[model samples]
Target: MGWAEKRTGIAFAIALFAALAAPDAYAANGAYAVDAADISEVGSCKVESWMSVATNTDFSAVANPSCVVNPFTPIELSLNTNRARSDGEWSTTLSPKAKTNFVPTGIGRWGFSAYAGGSFDAATGENLSAFAVIPATYRLSETMRINLNGGWLWDRTVDRHYLTYGIGFDWKFTDTLQWTIEAFGQAGASDTPSVVQPRFQTGVRYRPNEIFSVDVIYGRNITGENANWITLGTTIRFPVEGAQPEHRRTGHL
Candidate 1:
């Protein structure tokens, strides 16, 4: 090819990769244990779904669809449904969650966010759990970051109050390939202790474009049970057709 044609191709490639790295909702798309301190742009929405296979008693599937809106504050709202099947028995849970970033996430800086949510039994509407979490992030560079979390959880089933924590690291090898590893756990009022102990997870996220991602993860002791799990998850992100609200922050680590 001539020099001009070659130069044009290189320019296009650079532009495409830059768009993929743009600060958007996909930055926090595929985390299993620690949530990111970022949110989708206002008027943007996404749907995340995953299935995990482990022992018969620990197999589960989940669907969570969420959207960001700027009513008074820029917040992301989601409704998640989970179905667990084990030994021909099935149980369902419904959870609603809300999150908003307090400090914007950027390269070589720190960010913070807040999350609140509750879950109930789908069959009986019985309260199962409620939680409030503070998530923080520090971007070591444009392609690497660290996430930290601390929270409080109310285990309605056992009437126990627990403290939760998480630490995670992200490394982006390229515009389309990324890896993350995290450790998370909970501890209750020591006397009774938390039902679920510490857990570890690692995942690789693949983004073919700016609006889609696929993740495969391996988790250890996922649910306080000594079960190893393998999960496949995906996320689809897009902008709302007519709703337009000013975005609070733009760009990500």
Candidate 2:
């Protein structure tokens, strides 16, 4: 091509590049822009520990918590413990068990968890009781959930399994407070006559940040023989991380 045509082509290319790179002086900045910090991943795999105290139980207090695991995935590990107030009195339970929770398929993310544990009656330094529970939950909303739990207890001294089933409701009153109620007992199918026990629990959870949380729970065995319990606990998660399971929409310019 001729020098005049070549120069014209080069000038046009340079003009196009400059027009695209330059911004209008009179135009304002984007009104809705997502910052990298806001779009970054939130939440993490965390391990938590707890301490509970009771006024009516043989053991006045206990410290127990589970190992590190994600709540969305199935959890398999021992969760807590039961202790005796004094050594020579009743028995210190050294019960350990495995547990797993399965996600619900059809009903807005329902889940079921199963636990199996053996009890040791410290009086004789021998295992005396076996226990298991299958608990299911349905999320009623972002702030509320209902759980149905069935449990079985077998005492070595009696050689019979006690079956129990109950329901629990959790209400998140705020970002830092929650309330719960539950009722459980043998359903009269066991060899011996069954009795029902209803319980109520209330708690406040303090989450100062994404990686740390603490909760205080107060409970009462409402029916049958009445008893009260209080629990104070804190949990810390390492290298905090979390992600929302729900789908989202995005707009791009």
Candidate 3:
């Protein structure tokens, strides 16, 4: 099998093993928000997948599958793909992301993380430009935390760049339930109108067990096209042998 196929198989196997093992774990990433500083325990693996559909039929449906490998205490690597279908035409984009945690969770009152990644068209196999972001989180209380992301995306296809940012708050209502709300947007590069409109999203997450969690979210664009979308997703984590026990703390999802 090809390398991509092999990787997919391995990820699937790990996910299946995690599902069957049934350990207490937590997932902080949201349906529509990226986790700035959240990482699984060292030597563990996580699988996150979701499907989103637009309220209008003209917009394509998107399916995303992401796998994360945490080999050390402060660094994690991720591989993910976006599969989209519109009017019977399908396209796929693959991306690899790396995150470094400057302050590991529960180690201090505040945490920081930096991430960088790029996406490529599966059909053309051309290298897309890279992007970077710094995400910071502050612990307000045991049950509340706030996160912010600021970054830039350089578009090779159009030879343009854009500023991207997100602000969000996470609230834990119970050990197994949480809610998140965020506003995110992109601004045009160099005074041009932003290609990506801004949007507001809210979601709820429920963890029925330690290793599994579910999310439901809805969002709408604040400017241009008036588009609305909803997403459903689940996350699963597998603890490798010798990995540390789960760390429960408030941080970005």
**TM-scores of the candidates in the order shown:** 0.81, 0.59, 0.76
Candidate 3 stretches greater than 4 Å from native: 1-30, 58-73, 86-89, 105-108, 190-194, 222-225, 241-253
Minimum summed lDDT over a 10-residue window in model 3 is located at 17-26
Ranking by lDDT: 1, 3, 2
TM-score of 2: 0.59
lDDT of 2 by residue, 1-253 (tens): 2322221111101101110011100000010000000011112223344444446542333223333233443333332334445323543444444444333312356554455566565456676666666555566666666666566666565566656555556566665555555444444343322123444555566655555667666655422235665666565544323332111100010
Quality of model 1 by C-alpha lDDT:
0.62
lDDT for 26 (candidate 1): 12
Ranking by TM-score: 1, 3, 2
In candidate 3, how many Å is residue 130 off?
Answer: 1.4
Query: Candidate 2: how many backbone clashes?
Result: 5
The candidate scoring highest on TM-score is: 1
Which candidate comes out best when scored by lDDT?
A: 1
Q: lDDT score of model 3? A: 0.54
Query: Which tens-of-lDDT digit does each residue in 19-43 have in candidate 1?
Result: 0111010112443767666555565
Q: After superposition, how far is residue 245 of candidate 2 from its true place, in Å?
A: 10
